[model samples]
Target: MFERFNLSEETLKALRKKGYRKPTPVQEKAVPLLLEGRDLVGQAQTGTGKTAAFGLPAVELVDPSRGEVQVLVLVPTRELAIQVAKEVGELGRERGVKVLALYGGKPVAGQVELLRRLRPQVVVGTPGRIRDLLERGVLDLSKVRFFVLDEADRMLDMGFIDDIEFIHSKTPPRKQTALFSATLPEEIRPVIKRFLRPDHGEVRIEPEKPTAEKVSQTVYRVREEELFDTFLRKLEETPFRKAIVFTQTKVEADELARRLRRAGFRAEAIHGDHSQTRRERVLRDFRRGRIDLLVATDVAARGLDISGVDAVFNYKLPLDAESYVHRIGRTGRAGREGVALSFSSDREDDRLQRVRKVAGDAFRFVNLSDRPVESGGRRPSSGGRFKKTFGGRKGKGTFGRRRSFGNPSGGG
Candidate 1:
C-alpha cells in the first residue's frame, strides 16, 4: 500500500482519489529512492506509471511556501508538456503546490505573464521554451530542488541535446535528478554520464514482450491499389469504440483522414503542419469521444497518454521496428485488450522481416483477399476461410502448423 511508503497525507489522499490502490513495479522501486532525495535513472514503458513514480516524490519534496519553482521537468513534445503538468498539478493540488506548463507555439508574452503571476512551484516545459524563458530573465531554476528528464531518448531524437545541456546549466548543480526512458540506446550513454551523479540509483523494468501482451497483432498482405479497400473492409468487420490510424507522412495522414470522413467515419488528422491550438482542440475532441478516429504521424502522436483506444492501424508500415512497436503500443493500454493491424505489400517484405525479428511469435499474418465477402454486406463472416501464417524460420514460412483464423486470440 502507498501508506507503507510513508507518503504525506495529501499525497496518499490524491492517490486514493485517483483510484490507485497497488503500486506498479516502477513506482514501488523508484518512489522510495526518490523520497530519499537520491538521483536516479529509470527505464520503463509508456503506460507503466512513470509519471506517478517520479511526480509523487517530487511533490513531497517541494516547499510550497518558497513561492518559487522547486521542480523542473523537461519533455520532448508540447503534448507531453501539457500532460505532465496536469498530472503533477493534480498530485500537488491539496498541498497548495502550484504547477505551470510552458511550451512553444503559444504566445510567449502570455506565458511570461503567467510566470510572474502564478509563480508556480513546479514547471513542466519543452526545452526550447524553457531556454527562451531563461534567456528572457523570467524562469528561475537556481532554486529548483528536483530535476527530471522524461522520455530522454525522444528528446535526443528531436535533437534537443544542446538545449538540454543549456537548460541544465541554468539549474543548481547539487539538485536531485531523475532520467526516464523506455529503451536506453547507446547514444544515451553519454547523457547518463554527463547529467546524473556518480552514485545515482538505477531502476529497470523489463517486459516479457516488446509490445503489450494484450494486443493482438495481424499483418495483411495486399496489393498497393487494393490497400485502402482492404482497410475499409477490415475496419467495418472489426468492433471498436475508438481507433487511431498511423501514416508515415503528413500528406498521407491528411488525405487518409479526409477519405475516412468522406466514407462517413468521424476522423481527424494531426501532424506537425497543424498549429498548436488546432492540435489541442483535435485531441480534446478525441478524448471526449466526439472524434472516433485519429490519423496521426509518429512525431505528432509521441508521448500521447490517451486510454480506451480499441485499435491501432498502420496504414503503411513504419520504416523501423522501434516505430512499429511505439505505434502499436498506443493500444492495449490500461490492461485492456486491443487490436493492431498493419498493411504491407510484397515489395515491403524486407521491412516486414525486420518487424518480425522484434515482434517474435506475436506476429500473425493473414491474407484477407482470399476470404470471400458476405452477400449484401461489407463485413466478412468469422467463419470465412482464410490462409494464416506465423513467423518461423527464414525458409520454413510457418511457425507451427496452419491454424484456423476463426478463433484468433484477443479477438483479432
Candidate 2:
C-alpha cells in the first residue's frame, strides 16, 4: 500500500509488521518531500499521526553507524518532549537507535551524563534545556543534519523565538529543517523566513469533522460575581466525576481548587509554579479517575495529551482565540463525543464570538438558563477513561492545529 510513497525496504517491512497498513494523509503527503532533504512547513490539525509522518523521515535519514547527534527536535513542554521521545524510541527500536529526552525539572546531571556517554543519534528536548546544553558546549550542532521545531507556534508563543534563532545560527546553514504547527500566526512567519532554506515546501492536512454528538454542550451567561455559584450548580446537574477547569492565572488555579475542595469537591490545582514531581502526582491521580476535578492554568494544560476528560470548563477564557479551541479540545476525542462548557460574562462576550467564528460547523451553543421543566439531563458515559482514536490509531491526540500557506514565502 505504501509502495507509491517509495519507503525503503527496511521501513516498509517494519510498517507492515507493525500493522501500519496505510499512511494517514499527513504521512502520504509529507514523507516524500521531507525524504528529499527539502525544508518543509507542515500545517495540519491534531490527531493526524504527525509524529510518525515527521519521525519516520528522521529515522530513515539518521546514520546509526555514526555515534554523533544527527537530528534534533525542539518542543515547548516537558510533557511533549517525553511524548515525542517515546515515539522516536519506538520507531527506531529495531535499529538499536539511541534517542534521549532532555528537559527542565529533571536532574540536569543525569541528562548531561547520558549525553556524554551515548551521544545519541536523535535528541528530543524543550528549548530551555537544549539552549542550556548548547551554552555549556555539551551539545554540538556542527554535525547536525536533521532539525525539526515541532509545535512551532507554541514555541513562538512561549517567547522562544530568539532562543530558536540562536540555536539555528549554531547549525550548518545547509541542514535539513522541518517545522510543524497547527496554526501559523502572523508573528511566526518571521521565524520561518529567517531560518529555513530557499526551496521550502508546504503541506496542509485539513481538520477532520468534530464529533460532539455524544456530548451535549452548554454555555452559561452568568453575572461576573455569580461564576462560582453557577459552576457548582452545573457540577450537581452533570454526572461527570472528573473534569478540567481552565483559569487565567496561577493564583486563580490555586484559589479555585481551594474553594472547590472547601465546598466538599475533591479537587487539585496544577500550574508551572509547582514542582515537576507535584504536577506528576496530581496528573496521575486524575488519570486514575481518583481526583474529581483538576484546576489548571493555561501553561499547565497546554499540550496535555490526556484522554477521557469527561468535560472541560472554560472557567475563564484565554486571551488568545486559538487557546479557546485548545481548551475545548481536551474532552472530545476518538469517535466518542465529549462535553465542552464555557463561562462567559457580558464583558467576555467578544472572545466567545471569536471562538464561534473559527469553530465553524463543529460547535453549537445553548443558553443554560433556558432549560425546560422536564429537562433531559446528561451523564458521563460508562466507557473507559481512555478512548482509542478513529481507525483504532493510537497516540494521535493533538492539542492544536495549523492552517497551510498555498504560496509560501521564505523572506525574513
Clashing pairs in 1: none
- Who wins the TM-score comparison? 2
Q: Model 1 segments beyond 4 Å from truth? A: 105-107, 207-216, 220-299, 305-311, 315-326, 329-338, 343-363, 366-412
Candidate 1 CA-lDDT value:
0.82
Worst 10 residues of 1 by lDDT: 395-404
For 275-384, candidate 1 gives per-residue lDDT tens digits of 66788899999988788789998767876768888889998788877778888888887788788988876456566666766786785766444443223334324443
Model 2 off-target regions past 4 Å?
A: 93-97, 105-110, 156-163, 197-199, 222-229, 248-266, 271-275, 288-290, 297-302, 316-326, 332-337, 347-364, 368-412
Model 2 TM-score is 0.74
Q: Rate the local accuracy (lDDT) of all candidates.
A: 0.82, 0.73
**Candidate 1 global TM-score:** 0.68
